[model samples]
Target chain A: MSFSLKKDKQGVVVVGVDGQLIVGNRQELKQKVLDTLESGGRKFVIDFTKTGYIDSSGLGVLVSLSKKIREQGGDLRLCGLNEDLQTLFELTKLDTLFAIARTPEEALAAF
Target chain B: MTQPQPPQPPQPLHVRRRATGGDTELSLDVPSDLDYVGRAVELIADQLPGGPLSPRRIRFNFRTAFAEALANAIAYGNHRDPGRVVHVRVEVAHDAVRVHVTDEGNGFDPKGVPDPTLPERLEREDGRGLFVLKSLMDQVAFNEKGNSVCLTLRAG
Candidate 1:
């Protein structure tokens, strides 16, 4: 799957993932994140509005992405997830691992 | 000359077929490759009847559950061997949908799968597929050989 990266005036990157976040293209997501980091991005917000489904492989990518961002002294925010996705995060207790915002504006503000 | 067996009734274009009480059924032999996974999901979605069950919810739940099961079949079951195949069957009724995913690989005990929701296992990624399937699907059953699994989902 592909993701769109939007940078606000303060340089916070809001990455919106499109289509299913499945194993077939999960690496594309990691590559995009790494690319963002290389470009001096620190504050990050991943919007899941377009992503309807995510499996364990996708979750792994997010967990690892969160850790990588934190290791670089950066913050990661997640927002706009549908209820099912929200439940997934809760079930896996991943909600405790990252800053979750209900909207992109709020996620950006969190940074 | 042996009388040609009266045109062996046109094989319903499916490898495995069955009829279940009041439910519509469809079956196909899907290639082990991941590319066909989307088609499998769509086949299940097409069987769902439009009603009070939120379309979005149905799509998400069925898609996630079906995808997880198919992924397991492809990865763990067939070992990603393109030469192998996965047999998928689906039954949809007014209130519920039933699916069976049979893979060719050596079966493993479903009970042996650890709970990914456990605190210590939160970061581990490999085991969560089954957990997600169990959580989203109404019921997840494994065959005695472990090479097959049945997932059922019902409208709320």
Candidate 2:
């Protein structure tokens, strides 16, 4: 898996995940988001437009990151989940816990 | 013009295929490493025949569930020991695909696993692997020792 991180003009951190997010590379994602959180970037959006798949390890890291971000009084949103991912989130009942948007712009607007 | 590329080396996977009647059996032995999980899943996927299930359902359901089973075997069952190996046996039939994953560690009771969907446990980072495989696969069964699990997906 690969990840890209950038900030919008409004100072919202947008993280892009490319390829499958599974046990092999979940830590890299967590570390990147954690590094940004440490740097005082509050509002965040994780874009899954290019992500093809995610396993339990990937889901675990997202939950951990979301909790960490929320504990610091910040918020995180996810956008561009494909149908499979949507089903996964729904099956796990994680959709209720995360703020999901259709696009990065929509997610950024919410924060 | 681009230079001709060399033939790629074969993957470090042990595959033995045997045909019995209309069914095919494949066996693989991989090290207990998380890195091998994806490749193993892909190898198995390539061997699956097109049945009544749609391509999208086969891809998503099998990939997700198989990956989860391999990851669980490597990380939890074998404790990520490099010396340990995970054994995978697959039976591909006309109407279904079945896989068995066995690890080296002392197994735990499947029933003892707490429900991750519980409101109180929703935020927990671990313990979702079993839940995911069970949810996506048509049947998920654990051996009495719990060290081995069988995941089956039926053609619909």
True contacts kept of 1: 0.49
Each prediction's number of clashing residue pairs: 0, 0
The lDDT of each candidate is: 0.81, 0.88
Q: Tens digits of per-residue lDDT for model 2 on B1-156?
A: 999999865349867899899888889997888988878888877776677456886678888888898998898899999889999998888888888999998997889888898999999999898899888989999999999999898877
Per-model TM-score on C-alpha atoms: 0.86, 0.90
Q: Compute the DockQ of candidate 2.
A: 0.64
Instruction: Itemize residue pairs with steric clashes in candidate 2.
Output: none
Tell me the spans in candidate 2 whose CA falls farther than 4 Å from its real position.
Answer: B1-11
lDDT of 2 by residue, A1-111 (tens): 399999999889999998778998888999999999999999999999998788999999999999999999999999999999999999999999999999888898887
User: Who wins the DockQ comparison?
Assistant: 2
Q: What is every candidate's C-alpha DockQ against the true complex, given to 2 decimals?
A: 0.40, 0.64
Report lDDT (Cα) of residue B57, candidate 2: 67
